[model samples]
Target: MTEQAAAVVDETTVAADLVTQLEYDRYTHEDPVPDWRPAKPFAAMVGALLLQELEDASDGWLHRTLDADPELAANLGFEPDNPPSRSAISRAWSGRLAELCSTIETSARQIRQLAAERGSPIGGPYETNASEEPTGSSKRTVNRLLRRKARDLLDELQTVVLPAFELDRPDDLVYDDEELLTLEACLGVTGTAANGGAETYGDFVNPDPALDDPFYEDGPSGETPLEAIKDLSPTDIAKMVNQGAARVLTRAKPRLEFETPVMLSIDITYVAFYGEREELVRVQGAPEDKSYDWCYKFATANVVGDNVHFAAGMLPVGHADYHDSDAYPGKDKSYRVGDVVRRLVDHVNDVCRIRIRRLYADREFYATDVFSTLEQREIFYVIPARRDDRVKRFIARMNEDVDGNKQVTVKHDNAVYGPVKHGGTKSSTETTLVSLPPDEDRKEPQVFATNLDVNDEIGLDRRWAKKQINRYSRRGGIETAYSKIKEFAPWTTSTNFSIRLFHFGFAVLLYDLWLLVDFLVQTLIDVVEVRTKPRVTAPRFRAFLRREVSALL
Candidate 1:
């Protein structure tokens, strides 16, 4: 048995020092120490791992156990009311899995040795004898595996996924590969983030050599198919774009494992509109802090999970159709964000077939109508609290309370909403207001409004607050999703709302496929766990996708 293993088992008292030797062994190892720092104490994390080994529990059992039995957790050296979350443990384990497993193995041996010393040894050694070949051991093997996975994923995308994005065209204008040609052209521009007209395909992808098959004998001109696309209504384009996103998710869902009742995040994004086309002006809105005054607005709903992050639904905001402009004019009619949220939720439920567990939205969504909508739908939410006078007063009182300051940097109070006016009736909504410690990135202490229960006890308040905040941080992934989606979204200067919407939506479809490709590659690399970051980068995935698309031809 290793000395560090023996030391941990020999200590009878449960305190932080029980794993001192394990900490020493980590720093004194032959391999370079990891640059990552753990969120919880070193000893507390090690103790949890030991408990995990003892119980042989699943991934989320430890968190549930700790919360269910705080006294038992404290006896095991964890602070009462404050247990390390499952995600924290998983991250810590994955980051140092090789090192931690060795220590645990050594400790198991030491325990058996001590039992034998007392004249009754435990059973035979606890170890798996299975010898499976490492799939990712060599760079060549990894690339080969990745290519195979990519081919399978992309094949489905082409055959089943791309067809969902086909737009209706006049039969007289139709020809061989008309829909396929249009889809491929959009994808080509997206893959390279190219700007300008359909000629952007030739400028960026240079498809002359790649499209040399018989399908190219009577090849469509640069503006052959897409010129007709711009003639379609924005509603038609939006429907096709949404269908494409849903199709990719439906195809990937059976292959990938997703958490039950996936969490959803909705946020608004803007595309700067620079044009003098007066008729299209109705489709543009004034988004803040933009170089251009009029911009196209969009709302997107994305699945917020560790492994299965997919943008499932999208809505073109501030766009209206005037069917009867004579009586009910479209002049002063504006879109409500709360109504947008409701529609997005309905779209995911009815179209994507995803039952939402909770929603995390931007601060702009912190309105009474939004709260009413979510509460009516029975969906939990976490939104940044707007610093209105009532919330500001709470912050002031919290700052002056010295007794509360020493115990926890977090505090919570009930945020009661009106019996005033909601949804054409007098109604009320209630939620909790959480005041977190001053974030390093912000000047003011962070405050959030949530329907989730917050425990404000001595040892529990900090942990509960931190965990909630960490969960909220997952919403930031949607921003990253938008950024990566732009890499695949074709840049455009066209004032046609349909063309712009199609470009954005097609990019989202491609982005989801990229995530699925990376996910499949990850499964090939490690069947048992999911990594936070992708091994196959955006550019590499784009390369693989473009190659697969060419092969389909």
Candidate 2:
């Protein structure tokens, strides 16, 4: 028992130190100490609250348990004769949450300082940069150029994008435009600080951004960079910030504005929660770590136009498991693929100001209600047909209708009023189904529900089925977007849903910025009509910004 207690003590060195150092008066100045009786230390109250947390016990139960169990009371810093009331513990817990957070923060800071002092490079344990020389310039010039470009990017993002999005900034927000841009860029560059990019960034920024450093020859976040960016007219400037993610999402598909007949791809991406299951709002799907199993889901909408892929809207999903609610089937089955589809589609159309030409989804999102919902919105959709009995019957009927030894190139289109319903789905009125039979050319039967009228009046012809199928294939871009996005994440094991959400939101923003940067840089290259090209790719730009952001951290 003594050996076990010692092991526990060793494991809880930081927590024990925290408890030992904390002053009683610091947490409870409002509750005055009586002169007649001496007050107990705040650690005892904290210990009591912790005991409640560990056991997840109710107030009355915890009060009884503590009084009855002498061992538990002693372990929790409570005397058997003079046990603290549950009310006193609750008040203390409520009063000192911020202080507790600060204590944790201080411990974290000390750990980071220790690592830094030990001369362990913050770029993490791995080498981030691929061995390559700077493009079209000396290493010194490239570093200097990166600093200038970063400041320019931030200035543009702040003055233009923030105003355009009409996003309200919290008054107490510590990270200003410059800082957020740096952070955002790092989020893009390192993918996430937890991913080692922040450490890499910190290494560079601390040394380079100073006046003495060769990179900041013209000082930091000042005039030279701004002056260089001024020649870009309102149209050019508009082009610059439009692609940057405004308020975590843009007002419209700026990159896809002129490029018409766009295909919007809807897909689910998962960010795995390492925390306790009860603490998270999770869903079932492949979350990288557990791709084959159920995990937290994020439904994202991506659009491809003129060779540029734009990540449009992202919605976090909530899931319902059947085992938990057999008694109440009505309550457990609210979150559906159709629900996310509607949300992301509405977001893109209404919030993003992009008129959807067609929406493409994968096989997992296959449901008659999803098709019905799209039809109701007058949105065209292409999804891999779920080979259900009803859909199989439809395909079998089409296969039988084919005449002679001729290939089954025949296309069938029908309006589904209420074909199959599930999850309390209402009736469908104008939903159209386009089905293609399996043949030697196309091995499997293809099915899609779309609002695209097949009448000859609107250039809809026999080839429309093949054309739409090819268009739906473009949804593959969202998969690549997902891969790129996951790279930018700051790895964490935090139980706070908000922290996880922020990390994801920031990563999305960074990925968008990367796409925009590549497009914009290439555009400028074309404008210059020179062999000289963009030296910094997304990864390299991130490497540069990662150093900048990490330094700030």
Candidate 3:
């Protein structure tokens, strides 16, 4: 046997001897205990083999060493006709696969010390612009194999292994706080520090607004370097513009108007996954038409009040009604939009504890019935009225009065109006717009309508108008989330519906997991950094604790 294998065997022998001595000592002290016994010889031998497998230079080292040793070979009952090959030893190891898996898992958990020292990869694959290929040679295969094995092991634990460990009480099987924490550590976040890392969202925030301003000039010769860079190609400019817009939309923003009651902001995104050719067929009313120009819609709602928070509700367009010719009439068929908005408002009232007074949306949600429904439910709403002839005339008159440079505040008479042009067809509408003061430089306009009395003092300020516009614009963030999912997560832009659903679910789960990891890492950092001593020495402190416990034992 190699020296390492011998040492492992010796360590097991010493542990068994120590256990025997401890049991004897306890017996001498009249402690009530069962008779002590050494581990089975075969078990000890198997453990030694496992240790050698981990420590040896290659896969077949222990098997080769065993084959050459006559005594060891004889002990294992190997004959001339059926000598144990390396493959046989490998099969033997496979027989204790669960034990091996457990050992590897334990070793992986212990390697957190090394991982902490090395640090994790900041940002996900999408965020970091990483290549699609797996990082290392074995990484892909090993992760796949490990995940498959882990699922099987979890099933076995739930169905067989856990039940076998019967106890006096059933409650013992329940996961305790520490066990749950360990599980969170294992399955929660896989990589990198959450915050304070190079690629964290906070890192993107420029402290000085002047540095971020596009118009800012330093010792100007009538232009900054940014202006000088306009000489670049159109393709480059387009790429930069697209990327810049994505960055601006995705970056987190601060909450405004804390005293305002929470309201739902619902918006619909129509994605044409299939080309327009197939979509035209579905629109032409062929039920059995297997074409693909279908429109898929997702509606997301965010609650706006003291703090902006995500509301857990989504509305998906039904395939049947979405493409039905009779329901959606002409080219301006946008009934699905109204349905999604109503669902979001209903969800907010049902799920959120606070009283929601108003619902907010852009001109897309300008249905007369929508306003009526809210009024019937005793809810107020501030939706931008669609620009029809009447609204255009009103805006023109107001523009003349306020001279386009200043905001024109006006109130609409509470009178029901007639059919107005929407999408394409005309629909009967009844709503009035009361314009709040608008900031010309900010380009934010506010309009409100409800059956309830308007608080003119709070409503007339340009700041309020700006805040409303900002709140309404925040709904666009969901588009960024969708883009991130399509780019980073397992999701694809493919037309296969089943695969698409799978990918979407995976993306959402991934986002949730990322949030969970961020929370854990932030909590740990806060505890360590804000403590009495330097938090940077936490790993050293942990090592010290382990050593102290080992010495005590």
Which candidate, 1 or 3, would have the higher lDDT against the true structure? 1
Q: lDDT of each model, Cα atoms only?
A: 0.61, 0.50, 0.36
State residue 517's C-alpha deviation in candidate 2, in Å: 1.4
Lowest lDDT block of 10, candidate 2:
122-131
Among these predictions, the greatest lDDT belongs to 1
Better of 2 and 3 by lDDT: 2
lDDT of 2 by residue, 1-553 (tens): 1122223332112222323233344444434445466655555655554334323345665576667767656655667667767675566555644356344344434432332222222111111121122344455655564555454444333433333321234465433445444544454555444435434444455644566645442112322222232333322232223333423233123222334555678887766644346644453445445645545666677766654677766665554431122322244444566667776677667655567778888876776567867877777777776677766666665533336322223333553332223434334444455565566667766766555654222224545755755567565556777877877766655554434544565567666655555444433333212121334555676665454443343
Candidate 3 Cα misplacement greater than 4 A, ranges: 1-261, 272-276, 279-295, 305-308, 318-334, 351-355, 399-404, 414-430, 436-479, 485-489, 493-502, 505-509, 512-553
What TM-score would every model get versus the actual structure? Answer: 0.65, 0.54, 0.39
Ranked by lDDT, top first: 1, 2, 3
Candidate 1 per-residue lDDT, tens place, 269-311, comes to 7777766748875556565666788778878889877676788
Question: Residue 23 in candidate 2 has what lDDT?
Answer: 34
Candidate 2 runs further than 4 Å off: 1-151, 157-188, 192-204, 208-257, 273-292, 319-329, 397-426, 436-443, 455-461, 527-537, 547-553
